[model samples]
Target: MFEFLLNEEQRKLRDEVRELVAWVPRQLILDMDQDKVTFPKEFLAEAGRRNLMGCRYPRKWGGRGLDWVSTCMVMEEVGVLGYIFACVFGVGAELVCDAIIQHGNDEQKERYVKPLLAGEIFAAECLTEPRGGSDFFGTTSVAEDQGDHFLLNGQKRFIVGAEGADYFLVYARTDPDPKADPRQALTCFIVNRGPGVEVAYLYGLMGCRGGGAGRLVFKDVKVPKANVVGSVGGAYKVFNTMMIPERLGTAAMTIGAAQPAVDVATGYSTRRKAFGQPINQFQGVSFQVAQAVTLLDASRAMIYATARAVDAGEDQNHTRRLISQTKKFVTESCQQAAHHAMQVMGGIGYTNVFPVERIVRDLRLASIWTGTNEVMSMIVAHEWYRAYHQAKTSAPRDFEADALEAESGEKIYE
Candidate 1:
């Protein structure tokens, strides 16, 4: 249907989001960083009006039915706006909306995803307890089946969009199996913030401060039996399934966040004079710009490539391997780009007058959120080992046989 990597329609969608970035006042972005903004409901409503909320979802559910790569493109553009906005949009559409579309039953889909994609209400994913960080399967939350309803208990902290979300996608231990793997011991539920659901604390964050990240305590909260997502003990599957969008989306947005700082630094270097010439004339400053831009471009390429793989319904292992690579490599690379951009600008970059300071604060979270870079490294190494062993055992091929034979004396494994 299309010749280039992005089709005509996808290009237009990117334009739409780019137009949004132009329309939104820069002051709003600054205000969010200062903790003056609570939520971006107005922006969310405008995004829904433009039909940009759920690019990869079905049209019947108020989505455009676009591909995952298109969603990545849009997120990258949205990321240009600010990290909080990009994160709010990504969590609602990619994380929560996609989960409901895949695992929610007919009624649940009609109830949640439809309105969710329309921006009629907000949603939050309740994972990550105080004790467990990346160990999702070790969740301390428990949901007991109470006849027609489930009594949910326990608390989730550091949840983004917790203060404004109307619904929650929660995971809890339904039937704990001590001897069984923790992966299969939990269940997923959709809960509403009603009686017994409390917003315990709002964290004073160093960056990405808006959207009210907080602690949610569920004390004997009642959720209808129909609210369960997927099977009773199928949360592991749902979590694994959602990781693609979660990590990939985060990576794409980080690309956007990384670029603005580079642009700022480059522009500053061109204008800021030192020794009767522009600072950009110096290799010291220019190379930083070059490195930053290279990282940004590389991060973008990997994110969209992995996103296309996701759209193609690639093998789960392969998709996760690429996604982990993108998350780890791209995030760290972007974080470095941000730092370089700041260094290029010197003192002004460290101040709020320029955006590099804010970008440095924001980009730091990219490696920490969705999953830590350490976790991503573990996944990449594990997947690499699996593929390496498989190729050696199942589909062995010696591409360097001549070189190895010619250098036989160097082979000392025996």
Candidate 2:
């Protein structure tokens, strides 16, 4: 509906991504859902071969050097397939690559970033642990410096692509001081899966399966000093940078997943009969479809605006809030849309005979991962109030003055 915001090149990129998505076979999606495939290496390799993995990275690193909007476009199109596909695609293309492109030296880029985008290998991020998932600063994994190398010993949980990942982007506490600031206490590394690295156990998930989601155990793994990303103690900045793509990408892909569910429901209503009339002819059924479509369009529009704001490099604090809003709102809205779609289809939707059930399971995780929606709301509320005090600087718009009792007893305390 708001396609005008996209440029010619961006539209072209969208079409290219659509083609790639269309090329996917039905068996792959079914197998991945059934947990028959650990990782869709062949699919990712094909995407890399087509140069569709990292649309935002520079062309020098096998990416097309596109903008965020373009990248989100890729994410959304790929998302139509499922969450696992877009995730494995982005873990290497953006999440892992962003750290290297922004912090890792050229040598590290050549060794890790280039091949990952090209689909020659796969990469995964290790930030969550047995102790916590969202508590980034409270990391317990420690890497002891050993002059020539660092012995990294820790376990990360719920690492997607862990089973098939050629290497991992791991974060561990490097400082010995227990009181040290979390922002200054840790370091990031590109840890390859070798001798001491183990894919401890794969999870049995209800949805978003197949991409080798599992636990990782790193025991006395010798990581060369050269594998450090950014500075030794500046991983906080790297972690912050990685979150932008994480939330924004998740929000964008969710739009793709939800749209198809709505389509299936709407289409089914037209053919399915009730009392000699099409089911959609009933207000109850049509209204649900309307609400689902509205939620989807709204989600897409928010993503478009937020992606543009990010590309323009708006105020860092404001951009952060907007990204959080995008993630929280879009994920929730899309999940609701899928739920509505399921409702519209009645008995059929609840069964495997239709794809809506599968999509519902995949969309269920959107609000929980990439920072929970609860966490997102906290950021939004905090940012809004922090910016609230700035309103006093302007004397013209005295909203309180418009009230019947202008003074209002000065709010009793202020």
- Per-residue CA lDDT of model 1 for 23-68, tens digit only, reads 8877778777877876777778778777888888889888898888
**Clash totals, every prediction:** 0, 0
- Could you give candidate 2's per-residue lDDT for residues 1-414 as a string of tens digits? 356877898888788888888899999999999999989999999998888888888889888888988888888889999888888888878899999999999999999989988889999999999888999998999999999999999999999889899999999999989999888999999999898999889999989999899999999999999999998988899999998999999999999888889989999999999999999999999999999999999998999899999999998889999999999999999999999999999989999999999999998889988899999999999988877876667757777689888776767755
**Best-performing candidate as measured by TM-score:** 2
Off by over 4 Å in 1: 1-4, 393-414
In candidate 2, where is summed lDDT lowest over 10 consecutive residues? 405-414
Q: Report each candidate's C-alpha RMSD, comma-separated, in the order given.
A: 2.2, 1.2
What TM-score does each of the candidates earn? 0.95, 0.98
lDDT of 2: 0.91
